[model samples]
Every structure is written in C-alpha cells, then in structure tokens.
Target: MTLEELFYLHNQTIFKYLYYLLNDEKLAEDFTQETFTRFLHYEKSIKAGAELAWLRRTARNLAYDHYRRKRLIQFVPFLQGHEEQEPISPHQWLLQQEEAKALYLAIRQLKLSYRDVIILRKIEGLSIQETCDVLGWNEGKVKNTLKRALAVLQKQLGGDWDD
Candidate 1:
C-alpha cells in the first residue's frame, strides 16, 4: 500500500497503539504526527511488504525520544484542580487505588527489559510474538524476561497477588 493510504487508514489505530505505549493521549497524538511525518521519508526505506514494521519501529524510537525529552524537562503530568484535593478519610475510599498504586510501583521497580515484557504481555495484552516484535527481543529472551518479571512481582507482592 502507498504510504498515504496507510496513514489515512491506520492513523487512528497507530495513534491508539502509541497512546498505550506513551500513556498520554496528547503525547500519543503528537507522536502519531511525528510518526507519519517520519513515515514520508522512511517509506522508501521499507521493502514494500515491510512498511508496517518500519512504522512501528520508527514510532517506537520517536516515543523514546519523547520520553527522553520529558525526563530532561522534569515533566509532571497536569491535573485538574479539583482532583488534587485529598480525601478527609482517604483510607476508606482509596483501598483499591492504593493497591493499584502499589502494583504500579512494583512494576516500575523492575528492570526495563523485564518491565517492557510485562507491560506488553500483561497490560497491553499483546501476544508473545507481538511483544517480541515491539521490544525487538528474541522469543527466548522475551519468555525469560516475562518469567523473571512475574517472579519479581509475585515475590514483592506476596499474598496480595491473589487479591
């Protein structure tokens, strides 16, 4: 397919794909724009049938660049003013939230290779080959990292994992 046709057809799907990776709607939109812009040049580099893979790789690199820029800028996510207020009895309402936060913390503490596998497999619901493609990991490495990540999470959370 021509690059224009690909962009026209796959833009939203691509945006959603990047959205999950970036976890920021606006940032994902920007990366989608960046991806398409880069696609114009990178399209010729692809060997016809490989355009989709090229787009994914280019978008992944762009997402990393966006995150690197965010890190350098010390960016904090913006929030609505009213949502910033603390609850009078946060313990009562925030039990689930606390658990989720704990889970996120545990995930964050993992090494990046392990973390990527877990996010792709568990959170993003990608299959083994998809996760392998997204992270450019071989099958064995992806399986090993996923195993290690789950073990880490299990050990860290202890019995809470069952809940």
Candidate 2:
C-alpha cells in the first residue's frame, strides 16, 4: 500500500488511543495529526503490519505530550469558551450526557489500581500484555489486578455506578 493509505488504515486506532487517554475528541484529533506529522520521517522504512505498533507508540508519546501540555496550560491566567456540540446517534446520544457523569463517579470511587486497570483494558482496549507493558507489571500481577478491578467495578456498578 501507499504511504498515505498506510496512514489511513491505522489512523483510527491512533485516534482511539488518544480519545481514551484524553477523553476529548478535539484533543484526540490534534494528537492524531501530530502523530502523523512525526511519523512522516520513518514512514518509508516501516512495513504495513508494523504500522499498528508504531502508531500505538506514537500515540503513547502524544499522550505524554498532552499531559505535559495540560500541566503547563492549567497555570494559565485566562479562560476560553466551551466547545460546541456535534450531533450523535441514539446510542452515542445517551453516553454523550449520562455516561460521562457516571463514568467520572465510578472511576473516582474505584481504588487507584482498579481504576488504572479499567482505564487501560476497557477504555483504551489494551491487551493483557499491553497493560503489563504500560504499567510495568508481570503477567500474574496483571491477571490478578484485572480480577480485582472487575470485582470492584461489579460492586460499584451494583450501587453508585448503576446507570
């Protein structure tokens, strides 16, 4: 495939990673663009199958960049207007309002380890191995941690998290 087509194929995954990390479409879009811009240098050398891994790595870097930017931006002395809305399908329409509220509360209610597992596994769609890579834990630790995370979610959803 051509270089542009290679980019188009993996772009959605990159944006998905960014969206899960930032939980904001605009920022995800920005990071997706930045990912490709940086990727241009190495695009010629990478094979098609390897592109997904490359994009994931780029997305990870962009996520960290975003975190650093947010820390800097938070100290700003001014405010900007809120973002406008986009139309949504019925399923998405529901999550647009209520899911954010419920998810915010649920994550806050979870223990830190449980919350991290849920975010990495469910939100970012990371595999068990990727979770281990990101969190620097062993496979057994990942499995046990994931078990506890799900149990915590079950308890939280059974009460405060029902939506």
Candidate 3:
C-alpha cells in the first residue's frame, strides 16, 4: 500500500494507542508521525498482511523509548514541565461515578507492563493474539502478566473491588 493509504488506515489506531499510554497529545501525535516515517523506511522488509502489526510494534517501541528517557530525567525538578488539562467542572466531574474515576487512577498507577496489557486488551478491545503482536510477547506471557496485573489492580483498589 502507498504511504497515504497506510496513514489513512492506521493513523487513528496508532495515535490512540500512544495517547492511551502517554496521556500526552503532543507526544502521541509526534510518535504517530514517527511511526509512519519509520514504516516508510522499513516498508520493504514487512511481510504482506503484517503492516498493522509492524506499525503497532514500531509505535510501542517508540513509546517505550520515550517513557524510558522521561523516567531517567523525572528526578530533575526544573527539567519537568507540567501539562495539566483544564479543570473539570463540578458538573462534569460529578457525572462520572467516584468508583470509576478511582479505577482509572489505579490503572494509571500500575507498572508499565501491566498498564499496557490492560489498556490494549481490556480497554482497547484487542484480542489476545493482537495484544501479543502489539506488545511483542507470547500468549502465555500476556496471560500471566494480565492475571498479575489484575491482582495488583485489585489490591490497589482495596475494598472497592466487588469480587
């Protein structure tokens, strides 16, 4: 497929995946564009029917690399820039149940691996095989990590967990 067609088909998916992980719009857009740029560079090596997987893998790696760099400098106070969103109005904030909001916060607190699996598999509705492709993990690792992630989430949620 041509570059235009590839971008048209996968840009949203790629961007959403990055946004969900990073929660930073500018970074997501930057990485999404970079993924396509890298795709163009290595397009010849990608096999047929594997374009989406290849793009996703590239996006995931880019995000992880960015996260790694961010983590390294996170301790440098002056180097950090806060990018808070506009405050949620009381009405809008009240519209969401407290439990749901807490759950989301807890998810964000989980380790990167667990958070990635939960977001991709549970939130994004990707199948096991698809999650594996995006994460470059085997099915067993995915399943095991997901199980542990859920357990950690439950612990994080305290008695808020119904089951």
Candidate 4:
C-alpha cells in the first residue's frame, strides 16, 4: 500500500495505542508521527500484512526510549493535577470519562509488561496471536502476561472490574 493509504488505515489505532502508553496526548501524537516516519525509512523491509504490527512495535519502542530518557517518577500527569487540555475529538472526550480516567490511572500504575499486555490485548482489542506479533512474544508469554495483567488491573480497580 502507498504511504498515504497506510497512514489513513492505521493512524488512529497507532495514536490510541501510544496515548494509552504515554498518558499524554501531545506526546502520543508526536510518537505516532515518529512511528510513521520510521516506517518511511524501513518500508522496503517490512513484510506485507505486517505493517500494523510493525507500527505498534515501533511505537512501543519509542515510548520505552522516552521513558528511559525522562526517568519519570510518575507516569500519569492528570492525576498530578496537570491542567486539563480541552478535548479535541470524540475519542478525547471519551477518554475524559470517569471510568476511562480511572482505568488509565490503574493502567499507569502497572509495570510496563502488564501495561503493554493489557493495552494490546484488551483496550486495543488485539487477538492473542496478533498481540504476540506486536510484542514479539510467544503465545504462552502473551496469554500468561495478559492473565496476570487482568488480575492486577482488577485488583487495582477495587475488584469491581467484570473482565
């Protein structure tokens, strides 16, 4: 597919994935753009049908690099009384809902592995196998990590989470 077509198809997905990982809309947007820019550099090497997975992996790596550089003590800025930015879209509006905010907070408290599995498997609705592809993990690792992540999330959410 052409670059424009690929961007149109996967942009929101990548952006949301990054948003969940970063918990900062502006940073997520920047990483999303960087992910695509890296794709431009490596497009010739990426296999067909693997573009989305590649983008996700790239986004995850970028987030990791950012965290390493910043050495942040806190991941969720909103909880720290960071000034709220006006919602720019329906998705942003949804993210501001009480439940979504609580969930994001809970997810932010998790270790990166748990956060990644939860985001990829549940929030993003990626299948087990697809999550494995994006995370470069085996099936067993993905399933086990997801199970543990869900349990932790449930406990963190006050054991009220249905799933």
Question: Candidate 1, residues 22-119: lDDT per residue as tens digits?
Answer: 66789788888888888887666667655555666677678767777777321121122235556557575577566666777777667656666766
Global lDDT scores for all candidate models? 0.69, 0.67, 0.79, 0.84
Q: Lowest summed lDDT over 10 consecutive residues: which window, candidate 3?
A: 72-81
Off by over 4 Å in 4: 73-99
lDDT of 2 by residue, 51-159 (tens): 6657666776677676677763111111111356676688886665575556556566666566556766775677888777666678899789888777776676675
True lDDT of residue 141, candidate 3: 96
- TM-score of every prediction relative to native: 0.68, 0.57, 0.80, 0.80
Off by over 4 Å in 2: 43-48, 72-100, 108-117, 123-138, 155-163
Clashes of each: 0, 0, 0, 0
Winner on TM-score between 2 and 3 is 3
Locate the minimum summed-lDDT window of 10 residues in model 2: 72-81
* Candidate 1 lowest-lDDT run of ten: 73-82
Ranking, lDDT, top scorer first:
4, 3, 1, 2
Give me the displacement of residue 26 in model 3, in angstroms.
1.4
| Top of the candidates by lDDT | 4
For model 3, residues 1-163, the per-residue Cα lDDT tens digits are 8999989999999998877767778988999999999999998999888899889889888987986887731110011113465787888756654655677778877877888888777777788998888888999999999989988999998864432
Number of colliding residue pairs in model 1: 0
lDDT of 4 by residue, 48-83 (tens): 999999999999899889988998624552332245
- Candidate 3: list runs displaced more than 4 Å: 72-97, 159-163
Clashing pairs in 4: none
Candidate 4 CA-lDDT value: 0.84
Q: What is the TM-score (0 to 1) of candidate 2?
A: 0.57
